[model samples]
Target: MTPEDHGTEALSGWGRTMRRVCEVRRPDFDGSLLDAVLGAPRLTVRGAGKSYGDAALPVNGVGAVLDLTAFDRIVSFDEGNGVVVVEGGAVLKDVIDQTLPIGWKLPVVPGTERITIGGAIASDVHGKNHPGAGSFGHHVLWIALLRSDGAIVQLSAIQDADGFWATIGGMGLTGVILRAAIQLQRVDTGWMIRNRRRTRSLDETIAAMRAGGTRQELDPERHVVAWLDAHTHGASLGRGIVDEYYAASTLDLPGAVAPFPETRSPGSRRRRSLPGPGVVTGATIAAASAARWHLSRSANSQLVTMRSALCPLDRADGWPAAFGRSGLVQYQFAVPPNEVGTIHEVLAYLGTHGLTPALATLKNLGLGTAGPLSFPIPGWTLAVDLPARLLRPGIMHPIDKLVAGAGGRVYLAKDAVTDPELFPLMYPRWPAWRRTRHRLDPAGRWTSGLAERLGLLS
Candidate 1:
């Protein structure tokens, strides 16, 4: 049955692309899901609906959309070795809640806690400590993939190496990921010891970041993320605060402390009450356009704990509602190690051109995996969030050109406005990835807005 045949409304995403490409089916079990996918004209996988753009949207004229939320589960966990195997649809927040109490945590997490493990793997997402730990894909031990031909294969570094790499950041074009084995890190406590420093300009901010990052002992975790005042100019341009965190040693733990709270399943009623489109839009724009002066003032204040500074969204009820109706777009890109200075240049350009992104952050990234389409590079990366209202014609095109000119490339998972022409330049491995997909999905059954826009599918 068509998606409309089921009386479902048009399926879209945070990017606001309104289109009906296929019938969507939510399957709880992998076996049934695989059967449906294998029998479909084509298929694409989706999780949590967290993608900021049309990357998760089915391509026009083919395929069914497989929503994996029903498959969410924490299949297994090993507290001793900090290894957690979870279903592809399990939310990061759920994983964190289960593990954090035992003095363990996911090695890497994106800004939002609501994202699914599959989405994290698909995006190869990086976080505050990217310079040290790299992308989430790096810690992945294995993945169970359902190939287009209906075969289930478990891939890892030493086994099915190429497929493992491709699927890590392949944007679900390689296959439908069934589950993943992830490595977690040990922590003394659920708390984070943080340090916050305010810099005067872009140069100082970079220097401060470099300085903080080098201090392995002081900030052992090396969770360094900066908040740039995109509207600042001249001497104050790129002015922002750097927040760093380090895991506390067990011996150094406080004399009196509370243990991590118990894991509680959110009620079905609460989940059903998630804010609708209009609410999402209002919250995101308000948060994005609020007075920068006050924000800077608050960020300049003293450092706080993990609960206070990092992952603050976890504290609020229905935190996802913060994004508002149009939802949120997290635009991230990376530049080569030698070209780190360009980050400042880009920030300055944003400020001067009155294109100040509402939120701007910088992180250092390590070498990437063998994924033909993975986004990581051995360099520094920056992530920014923009309200949809600011996507004026005159503004976005020039910004896209600027990033491309600086030898930087946008993160496909987080992008909604990148130019189709710039795709090949950003991903030199695109041709190889396309070749591999051809072998698996010869008929081009799996497609997305990104695949079509970037010529990944015909």
Candidate 2:
């Protein structure tokens, strides 16, 4: 569809809170319109409107939201070598559907598949195998960037290295990502052979996860994500299981599907028919409730192949409806490697303080990216989803202080409660990032809620 077809008027995202600075412009695959926006008074790029927080929201609505969805295309794919190049607006689900049938898969993916490649790179998203694969940016070979000065720049580790590092996880403040070449991993089959082991204590769960990380042959697709009963106390604290897996070859199986089956729809049929904020919220809540119930049951755990275990979110229609009307906020933070024990302590505190999140997931990240405000580090990261109603001062504020004290910082892409003062403490590279950003965007034309809250703009 053309820009005018979707309406030239400004549009908000799925969150509906970040209104555009100027009229939304949907440019075709070429870089001409993007170049114009870069030279305009102010500009920012947006895709899919799936970002949980405000990373894609233009600051002050002064510039325009350069809608890149129109640029979607898979430029090339080499199944034998497992490398694919695509435009920035290509959705993760789209890539997976095309690649998985050929025994290839994205190296990493976030919880949701509705996100665009540009959005994923802007957030530098990670997945269950982050301890091994690192963030998505690590797998990227090069990117086509529309620079602040209206120049189309091709950046890689060796070419334009400085700009490349600055743009990855730069929250798209530096420029618009036009296209990217990513390296995909080879898998034996579309199915995952999974192992589910239940642990009675947080310590046991941690030990199991650490042990699982050492087994290279297993190449697990999922990890330890827990469902802690807030009402449970003391000895029963942090009781959960770790689910690990490896891709299983389906060559010997009869009538095995070449590509994986689509994910089951998360919301009800009636709910799917409805539209607007109210219906979306209700659907999200219902989905979350079902997921929580499923996880809570201690059923027979056995081995399952990759396709069954690592289902992409978008494949399951109506999945977005699970968060309900108030919507869900994913609060993730990383503490020092030595301070992971502190995460358990914080969980205990949350249980006692009546702030236990609905869902809690943990991962071990390798190192921090060079982005001025990147979130990962050589530490353990925990992500939790909480209802917006729980964001009151009495609850979230103290939790923020606790995380800060532990040398932890919230993920900006998932954050809605982070206090501005903690930005410098969590991200030591902020000053350097700001320096690079000023050099590229001296007028600070590009901005977002994250930038504004963290004082990233001068």
Candidate 3:
């Protein structure tokens, strides 16, 4: 089997902060190529590298990095059963473009369609609609995992419950995910009716999210979230805009199974580029937030396509590059509804340190996922992206103390820094997850920089 071997290249995840020189392996679509890589002394699977942190990155003491983009293929789509079987590396964008026109959409569409099926499963990614849709894994029917010892294992809740949940958010440590059968959502025009409003205070923000969070059925079309202003203080600590979305009215309604008669969706027209780090400072963020609030008056109850509704953030290309050389660290954590005070404290803490998160966001998550390593829980989740310079130890310590004390958990997928000592406290299922990891990979062949930092491989 031939291989596209880009020998010893510098590799990094989307953050572009941590770069490592490593052997890169790209496998072709044919069957034998994957087996060849599995036989390597050590290696880790990487897809799109859309993960904000090191979950998909291979660094020190790691093995060759498998660039799996070439393995992308939509093997089959069974509209009759609403299930699509896809190759592990099949990107969400490709899947959406192909399926949306045919009246189906990903049940759990993440913020960016650039994610790959393997990466989505490894991270157990949740979406704006997670409160009702749960997560990407919740809609996954089955996975074809290639174990370290050259065994192709098929897993499902009933087939291999232990391996199944472990692999869901197991951070690719369980095995190399080869393929998956996932359920798709039915859509008419891939369009939504959105409601936008400006909120003044933390309470107002929470109330708006709660009021807008009413669900229709299995889908969370009522995706409620707050686009917050991190530079604000005092009376307007969490002041921002809350946007809620619902199915478009019946006047132009395409029934769930009806063919999409119009174009799939138009892309965002936001600025495509920005000066790195210093250019996107606290002051800039404040201005941007305020501008959005004012413009929101004109944005209310507008019809938007699925792409516009689900991933407005991706409208701009190379946005993260705006963080410059300092890179970007997105600190995303979840705290129970009762401890929302922690959310306030986290924002207050960031402000106290004179750091303004370029973008701060809030969302209400659903009940905990079945996967032990899954990040979502019944709570309020806040995510903020800060320049790497502001991601100092002092800033994280106070936030960690508040979150852990409140029984809140950090999302491993978006994490760049967290004291390893505190991880077990955040994820009580660590022991069980570790045991399952050992069962699937006794030698711990499947690993990444995150596993090493979290002490999961130890």
Candidate 4:
């Protein structure tokens, strides 16, 4: 061979929050891959890079990033048990396409489809139906991890409880997850029976959501979420639309030349990135938020696929351009029931600043796994995508304090900016998590930009 050609490139997550110049290594899945990368002084694992924040990017712009994209292979599938074992780098979209046709889907899927199984497990993401379904970690059966000392081992909640929980939401610091076996949720159809209701104010929205599912008796597993109009304030501070969904019962079309599933969401097939930053101004954001409120009628006429219903903005096609190069701050935080008013205060703060929030999604969350750094808990969770420029000390810092005071925690997977000092307070389990991480990688070789920023290594 003439030579093994290698190239260096600046990498950033989907949100474009931070760019880091580093050496990227795409190693074939092999026995020696662990020894090769562990030789490097510092290393971090990256998959899909769809996290939209610093969690995937390493700090200090040094060390090699072991890109896990190439290792995406469906290793095994046991249809009888509804369990599938795959490599960590496997793309979730591919898994969905393969399993959906067979009446199975991921128990917990985040806002986007372009994520890796490793990334999902690392983040321990929550889905729209979190109150009923819990988080991504709940469905994971086991994982194969490679340690710094070149020892590879299989970890599961039962056999290796500490190592298992540590790696689940460990943010890739515990070790490099080589593969995992995850249980998939069974579904009868691919379509969603969509229902939309209008809430006049924030309190009404909260009440409706607290009722669970829909005003009308609906399935317990109904996927319900809300969209808040950031421009509305004062008496109208909580005005938004509450959408409730369930997998539509399978149906045969009257004019069907070919057989089709009961719920066909053509949206999952569509994928588009930003052509450019485009015209995303304060005025446009306000108009969009208003449009969502007005466009969704109180009636239950909307019908959509699972993909479309799960992430409407992703279906917008080229929507990420609105945030542009600065990438949006996917500021997500969860506060317990006592601090529910924190949402009102934060919304008021946004309204006063005249910063029309983008993609303001609200969902009632359930308790998380024993994973020390897991994000969700038994409470209401709000994920707001704000313009990166507006993430200044005055705005971001106060919100951080608001959450920290409520004994809440921010989502590391989606956070671009959060105080390091408050991190320990937000995640009280971090002290234990750090202990487990050190035990796994005693050399402190597995580290990332997010790890350093949030003082994960500290």
Which tens-of-lDDT digit does each residue in 176-255 have in candidate 1?
A: 77889999988766656666776777788878877765663243366877777666668876667777777655444556
lDDT of 2 by residue, 236-332 (tens): 5665656765555555334745535454324323132233333333344346545554465443334453534554443544433444544556678
TM-score of each: 0.85, 0.84, 0.93, 0.92
Give the root-mean-square deviation of each candidate in angstroms. 4.2, 4.3, 3.0, 3.1
Q: In lDDT terms, which candidate is top?
A: 3
Candidate 1: segments with Cα more than 4 A from true spot? 1-7, 15-22, 60-62, 216-220, 259-309, 313-328, 393-395
Q: Any runs in candidate 3 off by more than 4 Å, and if so which?
A: 1-6, 30-32, 216-219, 249-278
Tens-digit lDDT track of model 4 for 363-432 = 8887689999999888889888787766666567788898999889899998878888788889998888
Q: Pick the candidate with the highest TM-score.
A: 3
Query: Lowest summed-lDDT stretch of 10 residues in model 2?
Result: 265-274
What tens-digit string does per-residue lDDT give for candidate 3 at 1-458?
A: 44444577876667666777877777775465555565577777788887777887775856878777887999999988789999989889889888877778898877888789998998898877777878888888999988887777999988989899999988888987889999997765666878788888888898887766555235566677789877778988888888878766446553553334454434533232244454777777788877776676626767767677787657645677787766788889998878878988888888888777888899888876678888988878999888886776656876877888899889898888887888888998888988888888865577788888788777
Which 10-residue window in model 4 sums to the lowest lDDT?
252-261
Could you give me the TM-score of model 3 versus the true structure?
0.93
lDDT of each: 0.70, 0.67, 0.79, 0.78
Pairwise lDDT winner, candidates 2 and 3: 3
Order of all candidates by TM-score, from best down to worst? 3, 4, 1, 2
Backbone Cα, N, C clashes tallied per candidate: 6, 21, 2, 4
Count of clashing pairs, candidate 2: 21
User: Candidate 2: what lDDT?
Assistant: 0.67
Q: What's model 1's overall lDDT?
A: 0.70
